[model samples]
Target: MEVATRYARQVAVIGVHSPKFSAERDPANLAAALERHDVAYPVVADPDLTLWNQYAIRAWPTLVAVDARGRVVARHEGEIALPDLLESLRPLRGPDGFVAGDAPEDASGDEPALANTLRYPAGILADAARDLLVIADTGHHRLVVASLDGQIRFTLGDGVPGLVDGTGDRVRFRWPRGMAMLPDGRLAVADTGNHALRLIDLGAHTTETVAGTGEQARHRMSGPGAARETPMASPWAVAWFAGELWVAAAGTHQLLALDLEKGTLRPAAGSGAEGLHDGPLAEAAFAQPSGLAVAGGRLYVAEAESSAIRQVDPATGRVRRLVGRGLFDWGDRDGVGDTVRLQHPLGLAADPDDARPILSIADTYNGRIKRLESETRTVARVFGGGDREQGEMGDEDGVGTAARLRSPAALAVAGDRVFVTDTDNGVVRVGDLATGRMNVLRLEP
Candidate 1:
């Protein structure tokens, strides 16, 4: 993205998106994703993977550089560093060197107005005790605090994409995601795009950078350093467990731990490898673990890439898979143990009142809210997708499966109300567990 912004005139970058899941094949879903990520370049949807076959692409993000004459100049199979990519493109320059063209027009002007205040909200936290609903308004780069009754209480950040820290509207965050309340009542945020963990003092209306160096970590296995000194790769979600902050470092494929009292950061689990391997903490591998929840004295992880749910014992330092088969095994099936399948679930919320270990999952790609019973090892759809065709998602509100959701990214359970971050729809869908109905949360400014 930085490269595209820097050389927008000299280069023409086009994104070719190949669908990985059934829901991703939808044109509306693809457009929402592009807009949520603030994509400025033109992107073509390759629903049938025609471009993948033509380009011989074997990875989700393979970059093929084409010259001015439409000749393939260079190819990168995986994520390439900005400096490395810039160096490789130097060969395309002519003898007189590349000339800068006029600045590109703002593509955002063509986008439709959002239906509500929130735009691509990603993560949510329901504090039933405080009667508060905290939402990670991702695309807007801010945190919204709302009362349980849908009234906006307050907000953090200045609604600008930045990493600056200050008070109230002066503070800034870049696409912040998951959030957890500290023991002292402060809120901790996984400032994803900034690669930092931020602390919000709600009482004082102040925000501070507690962890990360404001730069993406080049090394996946770096840690055991001071909290402010450690460079972190995109920390997607955060959970407070065992008197520490557990971070799903998605970009590095590892779980990180930050001890607030000790002021130190270190790797808690994973081997920095992207796959589905469970065992000892140091040997276990995670594929883009994006969501996290703590319950029953264990930490639950939502692996987006593998479409799997895993549990980690903080005391034993062991990791185990609860559902999903492997990296390539994914769908929308409900059953017991290994028979159950999920399609890129991204958020989890523990049912506080349930004596049995139960979790509410935001099945992002499937556009459904599922309930997972750890004791019985059973998964079932609680909301969205009824008799409708598979992969057909919408924004209609109805009873149970009759309701429709579009790429629900994260959810939070408060009492009997399930607050869902309807990401692609840019709205929060509140579900009634008792009544089996769902409705859009109307935010009052």
Candidate 2:
């Protein structure tokens, strides 16, 4: 993200993707990942590790800077600090050091059908009473309001990317994610890309910033005094429970809570470290928790980087890992406890109709929907493939696993039906929780 912003024209960023898994080799899958990340540069897919061997790269993320004449100038392994990167490029920015080059053709294939409908929708929310559906249209940098029957009601953000507060077309957002409805009929938004929280007043038709300083948080700031003044780092998803808004702050690797009634924000879980350390809230660690579901005083976190499911007890301030083994231990396997594996699961939703508590997972990288019974502690695939099927075309309105979902991201439960943001397909899919039949909901305009 920094490189894309700081060196858009000064440097030509070429992503050499050397895949560790076979599923990452597919062009469509790679394209979806790049698009989800808002990457505009051309990326080379090196599935056979051809580039790895050529570069003699043994580490996962190795940065090598080549001069204008194609001579290797600097090499850094692992995460490089932005300041250090800038210093390394300082000497190479002279007139004789770098030169402008012709722009390369965009290799991202044909435009998806119904590009106007949605582009990589990330967050899904439903109000059964109002028959309303809210989607965080991530790729489009907008919010889409529609009926469960696929009728467009109102659109927010004006389909533009920026941080602006207003109403209707005047309001703007950059890759906004997760949304939670407050008790007073207001919507709290995790404006992920903008590093802020936004509030939408539907009745008044106005939008306002409730949290963050409209900038990314570089340092940790705790307590109520720092909450509104401090910048936030990628608030990915939010949930409202007990008069407080819970946020999955993905970029910061922690959970935050905004007291809606008091209008104060503070960290709720995680210690801003990336790992699986289950313990008290302040000491517990999480690896990029992208989705959250709160129920019965427990917060369910979908840790994307670790491919793990963890639970947090608000009253006790304790966190425990329920599923997934480790960061590198993820595949298309299912079972009980740590034996169950999920690949980069993102969004989670609780089954409202179930007598016993149940959670649905968007096992994103594996392209499947999974279910876990909170009481029995059993995991099973409810839809899509248990194994990765990269090139297979999705069967819309198909029954059971026959109905393929391309990169399902966020889920919203409305009675016995669940709405899935099929990110890769750029459409919303509704699934019957009882029968496991999924059909695409067509949106006009």
Candidate 3:
């Protein structure tokens, strides 16, 4: 985004989306994703992978730089640092190099204000004990705290994207994602876009930076370092387990651990490689792990890129795959173990009310909420699902498979109800776990 803004006059950025999942091929879903991410540039949806085949693209994100005359100039696979990218483009700045144009007009000013509505909420947590619902209003760059009945309690951040630690509205966050409550009642946040971890004290209305250097890590592998000194790479989700905070470092394709007592950060699992290999912590690989939950005395990960669920043994640092086949195997199918298929699931929560370990999943691409029984190894749809042709797969309240959702990113189970961040729809949805009935949660101040 910074690159596009910085070189707007000299560069014309166009996004070509080659979807890996069928649901992503839907024009509505694609449009919703663009808006949710605040993508200003025009995007071409290559649902048939025409562009992928023509360009021989082998990765999810392959940047192909085309010159003003339409000749391919350079190409890069995977993430690149902004500074490096800017430096590489320096040669194409002068006359006869690249064309310049006026900046695009901002169309957002014409849109009506949606003060009470969430803008692309990405993560949610329901504290049954406290009767509180916490939401990561990702696009708005704020965290909202509300009562279970939809009454506003308090909030964190000032609706701006940055890295600042202070009290209430004085604090700032950038596209915060998953959250976990500390044993002492403080809220731990994966300040994703800021590449940092933050702590929120609800009673004090204060926020503190616990880890990260407020900059994205350029390197793939990161070692133990002082919490505030460590440069993190897109810490997407966080979970508290065994006296440590576990982080799903999505950009690095690894799991990280933060020791609150020692105030240190270290890699916990994955070797910074992007794949579906599982074994010892150092040798194990992950594909954009985006969600974390603790269940059955183990940590479960939502591996988004592979559309898989994984289990990690905290005692031995051993990783194992629970569901999904590989990077290409994805769908909206339910069964047991490896027979089940998920489409880029991103949210996971352990059911606190169940005696046996049961996981609630926000199957993002499938637009559904699912349940996984740890003991039986059975997967079942809990809510969501509808007809795509009829446009029923988005922003509709119903029961069971009749309910509609668009890219539900995160969910939390609170006793008899489940709270979901219907991300692309920009709303928080609440569902009755027993009845499968779902409705949009209207927040009120």
Candidate 4:
């Protein structure tokens, strides 16, 4: 029998995040229990645990009952008997207002949000030769290349801002992200913090201006920030595919493909906008597009605000929804099982072997990365769901002081080696793909 006579209304609520309320975690026959009682309201199938991270779910099935006025009159944790559930409602009919978590400013002047930080920040991947691993150190505003053993092999931007490093003397990158090794082993960077993308020389440490002709915000991207009529505006993510480099322009809402040899870009639609496209790809635009990757002629993009995963038809430049609707709902923190709503996500990649064509997404806000199977979109792996700086990183380092991740913005994988930026920790961390284990690269001053 349905609880037809029970409470029924759209109640504003907040709940826990991913780590504590993982979807892959078996519910202990919770669904059967709910069904036995005929309770419904779509208790929210949040596989990624977005609500768990948001409300900081202290207790399982914690209850916060709000009155008709949107105030929380009663909050009970654990299982509340029906009589008590009704007893807690007495305040709703009274004069007392509901209780809200809104509080006064904290002592440090920092607004309180999630109670976690970054334990790992950067992820690394390699080329065909495993000659190098690339990292986008956004907070530091630089792109780093390291050895297989994690040594500082090379650094780009020279700690200066500019598209061409010393060539222009003014082409600086702001919050740089996304790096790809071209067929020739050259590196392409999405300098998000700087509003431009640069191509770096792996051997010489020289920076080349590839797009967004200017170093600042510009609506049209021609070549670099210094150029006119270019389409790049705050490019955040990049990918190399079929002899072309693709950039996800977060500012102007577009996907740009560049000829690595020619360094020229053309707008790509992936899938036509709205429904049917009768115009050029440039006519189509992405909404807050953050991360991009390509495999088997298909393009996968992560739109943060839209909270969706989309597939791009490379032939027509048309884009279509593959996962989220960009609504920020609760789902998967990683792309492994079911995709989840995110706070902000910034990385995407497909396994190179073509055996599975699996895609990996770094669900930054939920503090983990998820792997999804190809085309079918089933989750294959989920890791790093607890992205807080716990004062300690990598169990092997033994710094174990409750360290959590700060905000991991990017990721890269080669073999079983994974890398993280540890944005707040101000160092790059390393992990093993086999055991889901972690170790710090220790990039501190």
Q: Candidate 3: what lDDT?
A: 0.86
lDDT of each: 0.86, 0.79, 0.86, 0.54
lDDT of 3 by residue, 412-435 (tens): 989989899988888898999878
lDDT of 1: 0.86
* Position 282, candidate 3: lDDT: 85
Give RMSD to native, each candidate: 2.6, 4.0, 2.9, 14.7
User: lDDT, candidate 2, residue 370?
Assistant: 83
Candidate closer to the true structure by TM-score (higher is better), 2 or 4: 2
List, residue by residue over 231-268, the lDDT tens digit for candidate 2: 78889999886568888988778888887666778888
Quote the positional error of residue 119 for candidate 4 in Å. Answer: 13
Ordered from best to worst lDDT, the candidate numbers read: 1, 3, 2, 4
Candidate 1 lDDT by residue in tens digits, 135-223: 89888888888887778888887676788989887788888999998899999999998999999988898999999998888768554
Candidate 2, residue 359: the lDDT equals 92
Winner on TM-score between 1 and 2 is: 1
Model 2 alpha-carbon drift over 4 Å, by segment: 1-10, 20-22, 49-62, 68-88, 95-116, 220-225, 353-355, 386-395
Lowest summed lDDT across 10 adjacent residues in model 1 is found at: 106-115
